[model samples]
Structure formats: C-alpha cells, structure tokens
Target chain A: MSSFLPDILALFFLFSLIIRRLGVNLAFQPATYQLLTYVLLLTIGLKGGQALTSEFTFSLISNSLIVIALGVVLTLVAMLIIHTFSAMNQSDRVTLAAHYGSVSVGTFAVALSYLQLKGVSYEAALNLYVALLELPSILVGLWWLNRNQSSTSLKTIFGHQSLMLLLIGLVIGGLYGDIAEPMVKQLQPLFAVMLALYLIHMGAVAGSKFGEFGSNQLFLICFAIFMPLLAAAIGLGTALLLGLSIGGTTLLMTLAASASYIAVPAVFEQAQPNANVAQALVASLAVTFSFNVIWGIPLYHHIAGVVA
Target chain B: MTLVFSFLTLLMLLAVTLVAQSTGMVVTNYFMLIAALVVYVGWKSRKSVKVSLLKRGRSAA
Candidate 1:
C-alpha cells in the first residue's frame, strides 16, 4: 500500500465528521461557493499558462486531442449507463450525463499531484486539454436531455454561467500564454484570495449537501462511484492502445473518473432548476468526490502499474 | 469586507503569475489558500443563514 493511502483515508473520515457535525448549511455559503468557483478557474488558467510556456510538439498535441476525444466518448457511455439503470427523469439523466461527460478539475488536480509525488513526468500542456474537454460534453448532454423536452432552448443551454466563465478563462489563459510576460500580474493577489475563499466555500457546500444523502439517494450514489471506475477502465484501455505512458494513462483515467461539480451543476441549475440540485451535488460532492480523492487516485495508480 | 476579498483576490492573481513565471511549483498556493478561505467564510455564512431561517420558523410557529 502507498504511504499516502492511510493519510487519504484519515482525511476523508476527518472531513466527513467535520461536515456532519457542522451541518451543510454552515459549510456551503453562497458567496463562498462563488469564490470557490473563481479559485478553481484561476488555478486551471495558471496551470495552462505555465504549461504553454513549455515547448509544444506535434505528438503532444495529437495525444491531447486523442485523450479529449476519448473523454467525450466515455462520458457518453456513462450517460447511457445511467439512463439504462436509473429511474431518473429524462432531463435529470441528461444533466447527469453532462456531468459524467465533463472532467472534474479537482480530481484532475489530485491526480496530477499524485503523479508528481510518485516521480512521474507528464505533459503539462495536458492542462489545456482538460479545459478543452470540459465543455463539449455539456453541450452534448444538454442536447440529449432537451431532444424531446419542449422546455429546453439552445440559447439557455449554451449561455450558462459555468460554461461562460470556463470559456473566458481558457481563452484568457491561451491568449496570455503567447505573451512573453504575465499580463495579469496586477490581478494575481486578488485571484489568490478568491481561490482560498472559494475552497472554503466548497467545503461548506460539500458539508451542507451531505444532509441531502439518504436512502432515497443511494442508487445515484452507487452509480456515481461505480460509473467512474468503469469509465476509467475504458480510458485506461484507450490510453494503452494509443501507447501513452503510465503517467499519461493515469491522468486520462483520472479525468474520465472525475465528474463535474463546477460546470455541470451550474448549468443544471440554470437549465433545469427542478432537477434536484441537492441530489446531484450530494452525490457528486459528498460521495464521489470523497471516494476519488481519498481512495481512487492511489488505487488507479496501482492498477495502472499492474496493467502497464 | 468585500473590498478585502477583492483586494486579496488581486494580490493572489499577482502572486500566481510571479510563481508561474518563476519555478514550476505544480501546486498553486494561491488557489489552495483561496479555497481554504472560501470554505471558512462559506461555513460561517451558512451558519448565520440557517440561524435566521430557524428563528423565522420559530416566530411563525
């Protein structure tokens, strides 16, 4: 067993207790939630910027594009599975599909950290791919959900807050990356404060949403846990077929395994308010988030080693 | 307070840019700090909001 496994488990238990004792409402304030989102965005942009500073080769770009394509395909498969097994309404299934399709930045971050700790080298430019893979699944998921429903509109679905912020951030990161020096130096401190503020808010959000988990939510929780594993397995297979390194394979697998809390939930709230945000949030944040962070990262790494 | 948050956010952005330009510290300190702060403030706000809601419910009862 990896040395970090025990630490992850301990952290999970500790966070759960703290969240349960404090209550969810106390953990997830609206302002804090907004701040957390911003922080995540900034982190992603910075990572992309740093990665962009390095040399970009054709092979790296090609591999990234392939990984992204595989991500979308795996997301579709996950959505199909959810649709097949669960009793969720069409809209809910679609929303859930979008989430499964999208990448989880937190999960990706954790995986990146894990790989670095393991002394594994990977293409930092993959961060750009992570950002790229986020949006298409959302569009596809929304399209699938609204296919039969008259209530859905292209404008409303495309013009979501999460989508807009993510796109703007990605664009800025890409543009600024080409510049010789950092263009947003003035805003760095503000972004830092916002990022810290955002994570705390996310903790609160996760805590409050914890209450939303009950017997009624068990099926979805189970689905969330298993579906990622299944998707990761497929992603791993695809990576091997593409001859990606173990580190690259693990990163792709992690991306597949992670679900969207930031982008999907935001879009769902605006597009389908009645789709039970608490249920989605609780399942994604409380159950799956904890599982992936505490156990999945190390577990997947071990598995990838055996396979490789 | 909002001003503080805004000011802090600006400082964070600058710090991140400097760090990014310098060494390859994969972990973004500013982001982690921001996340921690947001969670703390969020928890506090949530508590106050819940208290207000509970008090209103009691009065109605």
Candidate 2:
C-alpha cells in the first residue's frame, strides 16, 4: 500500500492530464465519464462495506464520529486560510471553502488502496464517515458565504449531481451490504474495467494540461501541495490526543488532507458560477490531486511511522 | 471467478509495492528526475505552441 501509492498516483495524475489534453469534449461524452465515476464509486462502496463488516465496534463508530467532526473543523480552517491569502470575493471564497472542505473521491480511493496494500486495516464505518463528511461542510461553507444574502435556498445548495450519487451509493451500499452479492458479482468486473479505463483517460487529460501550470496557477498549486501536509500534521496530532490507532490516525489525516474535485466543483458551478472554474479545476485536478497521489500518501505514511 | 480477479488485483498491488521497496532511493530519484524532465518538456512545448497560436491569430486579424 505504502510503496505502490506513489506510482498509482503518478499514473492517475498523468492519465487525467492526458484525458484533458485529448479535447474530446467531456460534455458530449457524458455517459463514458459518468460510468467511469460510477465504477469508482461502486468500488469504494464495496470495499468500504467489506471494511465495515470487519471493524464495527462501538469505539470504531465513536472514532468515526470524531474523525467526521475533525474533518469539518479542519475544512473550515482551510477555508479561512484560503480567504486570508486570496483576494477572492465572498461567493468565491465560499465556493473554494466548500471545495477544500469536502473530500476527493479519487484521493480517498487511492488512500484506501494504499492502506490495503500496507496491510493496515481501518474501521469500515469510515466509509460512512467519508460519505457523511461531504455534504455538511459544503452546507456550512455555502451558508457562511451566503449568510449576508437571504435569497439562497437549501434545496438549491444540496442539489448537486455528485452529492446525489455519493448519498445514493452510500445508502445502497450500507443497506444492501454483501447481500447484494449477486449484484456485486455482476457489476464488479464491469466496474473494474471501467475504473482502469477512466484512470487511463484521466492520465491523458492531466498530461495534456501539464502545460497550463503558469505563474498564477503556481501559487494555487503550491497551496494544494502544502496544505495537505499541514492539515495532516494537525489531524495526526489531534488523532493521537484523541487516542486513535495508527491506522485510524493515518485515515483521519488523509480525510483532513484531501480536497474535493467531484462534489464541490459540481456544486460551485451551479451555485457560484462566477468562481474561477479553470483555477479551481487546475488546482484540484492538476496540482492537489496529483500531489496527493504521488507524494502525499508516502509522506503521511512516513509521518505516521514516526509518530505512531 | 470474482476471487480470481480480486487475487489478481492484490497480486498487482503487491508487485507494485515490492518494486518500490526494492528500488526505494533509486525509485525516488527516478521520480524526481522524471518530474524535472516532464516540467522542462512541458514548458518548452508550451512556449512554442503558444507562440504559434498567437502568430496564427495575428495573421487572421
């Protein structure tokens, strides 16, 4: 898990860049991308379910709650940091904040694979923790951004496609468990193939956009790179103080460190279209996503080894 | 059949880790060197590409 993460991440980062560069018009190829995303989600759900069945103790649930709380708090702190640094307006700040607050599914998937490889077992409830942590911080960030204005509706805020899929995936996975074994068997191979293809496409997209890393993008990219480490440090310290295991500490740190590209971006597009999608997308997809995959996991593992 | 896939995935993951572990410092150095190479290539290519695009636009104008 530890060793393969860097390579897997690097591959994904390159894949995303290549896909972007292909200029194949993602909008027209919605089904392909959508299936790719679903497969990823389904993989996450199944793995999470399996993990949950293994480690569903009272303490695990309690710790998951703690992790969720910490995730939200850390997200707010990251938002505050972004606001302080960038001269972004309130709406843009809120949009960015919501983004940094929510976890990236891609990053989480990589982290999960990393952990599994390293032989580190975490609580299955953490899947729910991952799902639960996505929406609230978004709400909080949006509410904070719009508190001055009275026109925004909650329905409008929560009505995001990625968010809907996440919630539905979680519910279906949790309720069905492995009882959906027939379904799992039917879907697993298809999902696996789709995941690999999506990843390949992602690599192509990211590789093509590698040229877009200009001076302005540099600052945003640097923020994504370093912020995860800083957040992980804070999370690790907090997790230790709260008395979590080594695995728990690592997962918590990961959750804190990850930035959402999926749910947050979709929401921002609808809610705050004025926010720089190009900037956010470049930062999240090109900078942060790549860094987390290649370097961040190893750094976290090294840190966890030192501390734990 | 499902188990076979799972086993294969696990094996692939294991292979990845084993290679990284064996190479360790060499792998890290390789990554850093490759990253530098990619950046340079990307920058050089981008400059020419941007220049060409600008020239084309000016000609049209």
- Give the candidate number with the greatest TM-score: 2
> Compared with the true structure, what per-residue lDDT tens digits does model 2 show for residues A17-131?
5556776422226687787787777666765665566556677667666766766786687677666566566665566566667787767766766775678876566566677
Please give me the DockQ of candidate 1 compared with the native complex. Answer: 0.02
Model 1, docking class: incorrect
The superposed Cα distance between candidate 1 and the true structure at residue B13, in angstroms, equals 41
Model 1 local distance difference test score: 0.63
Please give the range of 10 consecutive residues that has the lowest summed lDDT in model 1 chain A.
A1-10
lDDT of 2 at A179: 78
Model 1, span A205-301: residue lDDT tens: 5666666765435456556666667777887887686676778778877877788887778777877777766666677776566657655666566
lDDT of 2: 0.63
TM-score of each: 0.67, 0.72
* lDDT tens per residue, model 1, B5-46: 333433543453354435432334335534554564466557
Worst 10 residues of 2 chain A by lDDT: A1-10
